[model samples]
Target: MGIDFLHKAYVRPSTYTTCIILTFMDQITYYGGLFFMTWATFERHLIIFHSAVFNTKRGRILFHYLPILSIFVYITLYYISVDFFYPCENHFNYLAFWCGFICYMNLPIPTLLGIELIAHQVVPMILIGIFSLALFLRVIFSRQRLRQSIEWKKYRRMIIQLLSTSTIYLIFTTPFSLNPIAQAVGLPPMFTTPVYAKVSTYWTFGVPICVPFVILLSLPKVKEKFKPLLKICGLGRVVPTR
Candidate 1:
């Protein structure tokens, strides 16, 4: 959220350094999310469909932490390359609000954009979709002896919610994902005017708001734990009757 704020305030000349910092943070945040989501999809697949393997320390470290660290290192290197070639530039056109103040790279537009679209958007989306579908099938085909059990139902609900959230994230981001292809191919840029940029930017912000809310809502145990706290603050009250 702080990065989002800095991104919004990039119009200020005094905040040029802040904007640059925010740009790096933005790259980290964007790719970090892609990597994490990819890891999460695979993790859930393991936990649900292959618990024996997922439960091991070696498996956890290998599948979980290693991928996260690799993503951080890879994105750090990629951004370093980007900075070496085309340092961040603050642009304040009428489209700045939508287009953002940080201009990443101008020279290697096609090559870099192609790489980003594939790596950050296309590949991650495909992997997530595949793993999520695998999980869905696992839930469907698993033995039904315990289908009525509370734990089994809980896992089923969580899987359904996970699929829903992943679908939403993909749908919301598709436009932003494809928008760069236009510029890469010499078509009119996606954000020609502030009006267009303003309209398109909403997709980018959707995940930040929707994902947390969905997670909280999807977890019954979490909501149950929060009930007491909300009641203490008069936020969740139950009247007593004689």
Candidate 2:
């Protein structure tokens, strides 16, 4: 919710209070989710393929938290520095708040666009793809090494869930991630088309909307938990005919 709010703040007009809220929330949600999810994928890799390292106290602490802390620190410093170099107050643009800010920054336009593209899309996509492929390969090799089909069956559902989630994430986020890059690479009309902006908005916000449906579909366990709540709300009754 906070992340979406910050995204909205880019196009919406902001007073002082809202600007501060957006500034802080943007850093936390944008960087927080990116770092956490990426690290979680890596942790899953360690757990599945190298449990020995994952079980160690030092490994647990380092893998579990060090990346998050580093990201938090980096985000804090980066935003502070961006604001210092390109103070929002001085270069405010209610029409295109974030785009304006980025273009007005001391950094070269290409460098700024490249940084955004790498940070938001390319890097995350690469990390997810690599980790997910490793996971798939681990599953295959584990089956060969264990020689007991039942041994890996228990993890099948989890593997499916991860792969499906990652696929959906990439599908939904790729266009938005590529938008600026597209604009930079002689595709300015791609974004200028009114339909593209609206479609992009839907895709951007559609991710969260789709996630719950994905979770319910991917994990029967989630549906099981939700079923009882639905029954409590009188929405899970079955009709019978005599």
Candidate 3:
């Protein structure tokens, strides 16, 4: 009965569109997660530092600014993704200009090819490695401070929740980042060699499904929280409001 209700609810076109948009947005954000991570980490630091100085007004301003900044960043990344990373069928691949020239013109190609290979493969790997290490250190330091503070008990669960979210994000994204690197270096297919590409894809897409469930399960007041509103609508009898 519950399954049928959910099936009917999800059958709406708007619902399906929302799901599609969410999937696309999630994937794009995963691709851009490294950039978002940098900004998010910086925002965390700013909030921590300004906790005392930035009263409700300034703190509210900062809170608003972070989402705006993130949206702008995402838009910029969308431009890069559409224009540069994955050019359209009619678009020229300027990134491949040199490679094409060398391969076709046969003009002293080895050095140019090597340079292209390194630029495409080696540089990104190095950057991601450094960024991940920096993020790990930042998280560790922040966690240690939280542990030492008097509010440790109050914040402990929240800290764990954030860490779990970060872990899920990393699990979803790390493979996508590394997959191209491995392929570029001529490594055997991740799937055929005991590691499966489909598995990575599944895990990446699974994050969106998993995150909401995790939040819903962890948070208290699942029933009382919405019961009053549902009762007002005559959807069902109201349980006592918490």
Model number with the top lDDT: 1
TM-score order, best first, reads 1, 2, 3
By lDDT: ranked, best first: 1, 2, 3
Residue pair clashes in candidate 1: none
Model 1 TM-score, 2 decimals: 0.71
Q: State the TM-score for model 2.
A: 0.70
Error of 3 at 102 (Å): 25
Residue range 177-218, candidate 3, lDDT tens digits: 455455556665662242564455445665565666555645
Models 1 onward score TM values of 0.71, 0.70, 0.47
CA-lDDT, candidates in order = 0.67, 0.63, 0.47
Model 3 vs. true fold: TM: 0.47
**Candidate 3 overall Cα lDDT vs. reference?**
0.47
**Lowest lDDT 10-residue stretch of candidate 1:** 92-101
Clashing pairs in 3: 190-195
Once superposed on the true structure, which residue ranges of model 3 sit more than 4 Å away at CA? 1-38, 45-50, 53-64, 76-87, 90-150, 184-198, 222-242
